[model samples]
Target: MKNILITGASRGIGRATALLAADRGWSVAINYASDAAAARSAAREVEARGSRALTVQGDVTDEAAVAAMFDTALDGLGGLDGVVVNAGVVAPSLPLAEMSLERLQRVFDINVLGSYLTAREAARRMSTDRGGRGGAMVVVSSAAARLGSPNEYVDYAGAKAALDAMTIGLSKELGPRGIRVNAVRPGLIETDIHASGGQPDRAARLGAATPLGRAGSADEVAESIVWLLSDAAAYANGAILDITGGR
Candidate 1:
């Protein structure tokens, strides 16, 4: 069985991925930020699905905290096998001209800088050349990366676009180290993220226009993330897949 760590796994796509990965017999170490209660509940759910589970608390933007999260996960799981870079945030809708510096910093710091730090730690731990077994990495990007998210969240969009580039570069860099890297750019997923961005009904209102005629579920995105981490996608590398329902 595989052992995996998923950042922001207390709820939303991260939580869904953890549960599904557990269902497939993967030991899961879930990382949550400022939500001990929710993390505990998520861990219980993972255990119910017949997998070893642990929850670690950390803010992904902190380098020290990211490293500590990895250490805690490795200690709890006994090894490293996979990691999902899923922790991120979205701010209120605003045009690029109207956005504040603080907002931009928070968006990029978490989405771009935090993601890179988390992925770097995973690479360091799971690299075969580093006295560890090979592993897989899945970065949760967003449709905003490509769509530009104009007049809404250009900063968040730009951050994800940087992540997309990072995913591509890391795939090549880690491939030689025995880590497979891939990314999923999810579109209009029904999750708490919309609410956090100050528009709780955004997905519902926007999803109706998608070709699929509805918002995608966190479970839908989770399925692809777990697959990319499995041997089924052994040959898949540096791929930026879009789960946009043809939008």
Candidate 2:
């Protein structure tokens, strides 16, 4: 079975992806930052699907912690086949002029730097040039990357935009080595992330304004992520897909 490690798999899209991937026959390593209980619950769901599941706890922004998470996943799952860089954070909505440096730093540190660390480690373990089997990687970006999210969390938008650039560049850089890199930009998905951003109903409110007329579920986004990691998308590389329901 293919082994996949997903960062921030304790909840939201990450949790949905873990369950779906396991149901599709992939051994999963569910990584979470602070919610050990949630991570274990997700792992139980994975195991309930008859696939191997492991819970790995670590702060994605910490270099040593990231390395340890990957190490534990590799040792537990036998080998790595794919990874979903899904860990990210956002602060309360504020205009650029009012945004604090601390908020920006925390956002970029977890979204940009964290993604870099996870993708780098995945490359080290999956690059054919390094004598390991090739693999796929999916970065969970946001539609804010393109829409710019002007007055609301522009810093988060900028960080996701960096991931888009990295997806394009890394895909080409690693293509020859048999690795595929892609990103999914989900818009106004119904998840607790909005609550953390101090807007518990943001998805429902903004989603009504979208072309689809409603908010998306975590499962909807998870479907796209898992498909990109599967062989069915063998020809899809360096693609930044928008799962915004036509928004």
Steric clashes per prediction: 0, 0
The sequence of per-residue lDDT tens digits that candidate 2 reaches over residues 10-96 is: 999999999999989999999999999999999999999999999999999999999999999999999999999999999999999
Candidate 2: 10-residue stretch with minimal lDDT: 123-132
Candidate 1's residue-wise lDDT over 1-247, tens digit each?
A: 9999999999999999999999999999999999999999999999999999999999999999999999999998899899999999999999999999999999999999999999999988999999879889999999999999998999999999999999999999999999999999999999989898899999999999999999999999999999999999999999999998997
lDDT of 1 at 37: 98
Per-candidate TM equals 0.99, 0.99
Question: Could you tell me how far off, in angstroms, the CA of residue 78 lies in candidate 1 after the best superposition?
Answer: 0.9
In model 1, which runs have C-alpha deviations exceeding 4 angstroms? none
